[model samples]
Target: MTLKLLVFIHLLLLIFMAVGCNAQHSPEDFDQVNLINSAGPYLGLVVPNSFELAPLLDPSTFIPSKNVSHIDLSGRRFHVGIIADQKVIVVMTGLAMTYGQGEDDELAWESNGDYTRDIGYIHFANYSTEESCDNLLNNVWFNPDEIFPKNGIPEVREHAFWVNVSETYYNLAEQLQNVTLESCINSTTCLPTTPKIVKVERGCSASILAANAAYKNLLHEKFNCTLIDMESAAVALVSLSMGKPFIIIRALSGLAFSNLASKNAVIALTKFFELLSDKPTNGIEMYDK
Candidate 1:
């Protein structure tokens, strides 16, 4: 009787130990809402500043947990936040163009005969916009122009050699209605109470240019842009590739060729906040998987 009891006890202990080991090695559910990810399906907003995210997120509701340790993009820091019960990631797209120091800066080659600074936005294509991991396993993209009707971002039909800006997003004018442009001429301090959100059917993004002043024709006419920015085109490409809905609201800075020689960063920032704060009724279900 005593020997049988000992065997039973030992067998029970072994069974318990095996169960514990399996639990310890079990995989984690990445779908759960956490500091680094969204609680539900998500929307991606690629903008330049934290304030820019305000239109979609409330500052007080921010999780306060910084998401700076992505293994793939460890060096690059990103912030994750929740907005309207959806996960939203804000990424700042930096400058898109650069060149190397050589006799012919455009045609410089290294000892290995590779172009210097050849690795531009093209190298890490989609690097900045990948922060928001909201994509359906299968998605059907619609013509943004047909759906939104206002489709404000730039539209480039034929690709240019040095320029690759094309595509469009929702209309900022309609989504962010009743915006008025500032007219505080001769001084930056007294900006208009409301800045205009110039929605565009066609626009372009490129390096800072004084084409407006030099050409007398609207610089936008020269580049076919009603809007211009350093990173809009690349951001558009990123969102479109992911099959997620995207929109851009650009506050009208001084005309590219205007005599002001100034940009109303405040207008852009404020308008972004206003639009985000005013939630839209329209949105795509990028998480219906």
Candidate 2:
């Protein structure tokens, strides 16, 4: 063969290999047993105050017909053990707080005085007085600086699993301290004399922008996957930027304080678990891939 022809063939082979490496995984390609085992931190954020996986704890309900042990990480729980001779580990983490009366008020945001209203941008204005804000900042898990220091980054355990529910929106709201007039233009009405609107965004919806921006910075710093659940786009962005696989699963619990039944929380959990078991639907896997 001519030397030029040989070089061309080599280049084609390289291209083929590169494409093969980046190819997406099909349902058939994933071993069902392997997938179940690989799934970690089936994190469920915005979980109801009464939420409980006690059913999972009951071997009769859904525990695989193998060695499956359940561990309760405070409110975060999961099943770990071998299933069908394959090791299956599932971790479930609750949201930062629950929603409802007599719940962790720190995690809950309020619009007027009642916790029923959506307290979007208001969190920024109320952060200093919010107890939940203090807990989140001081909490070892939420604060990256406390968990992973700047000087020496600790090695994350390959199997050490963690999952989050849809709590990022609230978390972001808690973090945002100030808002400029430019960002809130149409969504909010402001006076020209003031130049800036002091109105709070209620639910940390405004914080989403800032959180996603910060996530980008974190991604550049490290290659890791960050899975953000529904209402947790900000957290997901941070995880995505780090090159980490971020899986977000959001269950529609209910509209904010619309007299919705508590049963909705259970239904949301069911839907979330269904999503977890079935192949990616509604293009949910696009971000993860």
Candidate 3:
């Protein structure tokens, strides 16, 4: 199947599920609840920070609604617009995934990297090892690992397993296994291989960057994590608490302990949103088998 079909399938599942499993909230002390409730069944597209948000908000990708005004609740500013024809509310979580130094550092990449490792959509986040792992220079962060039921983790939860992407989305991600991703910064500064989409079984989120090759290997070997980041697992926990469906799309810019892969993030994101624009906004149509 083509990437366009894959993109359509994803958006279809996202919106359909969003509409079907709409969660209602009681009015609380803050009037922000009322404003957000009136926003109507939007696909909440979240990013870690402005760097990731810029691509989605770009004129070529996200088209703002002229009729509706933007909403500011709490400190977060939400932009309601049409992206790839689907109505979405875009917001930045103001989080960071990158830490430690690049190049010249002990943890810097020392060899040629796999440029073909971009674009991974996760099925599960392994936050189970948070308490066991060391913190970022002794700073304490919220432990999402402890919020689960005491009887150990189950295969699925009643409210969709913390915005679980579902087995269907996992299978759909397999279609992009051959999709080409950006691998070069410039002619002379290109990676050795082209990037491709991956189906991540488990991704771990913590405060520290996986800058050490040994540390990266430890997480992979011990936890069976395909990738590590700073925020997805926490987001998963929050979504689970709120009883929502969600998915995380991770664009790999560089490999841990290898050559610093640069510019691939922008390249991968540009390609990603471009594919999103191919489908009709309403997304009522079904994909052919």
Residues 1-289 of candidate 3 have per-residue lDDT tens digits of 0000011112212221123235442354134434444555555666665545665677877788664535554456767676655566666664333222345332222232311124432222243347765433453333224444324366443332223543433444455566665555557776667666666767666565566565578778866777776666656665444444455566665433012222333334344444545533343322211
- C-alpha TM-score for every candidate: 0.43, 0.28, 0.57
lDDT of each: 0.35, 0.29, 0.47
Clashing pairs in 3: 85-281, 109-258, 116-194, 116-195, 163-246
Instruction: Give me the candidate number with maximum lDDT.
Output: 3
Residue 136 lDDT, candidate 2, scale 0-100: 32
Cα deviation at 149, candidate 3, in Å, is: 10
Sort by lDDT, top down from the best: 3, 1, 2
Best-first order by TM-score: 3, 1, 2
RMSD of each: 20.5, 20.0, 11.6
Clashes of 3: 5
Q: Pick the TM-score winner.
A: 3
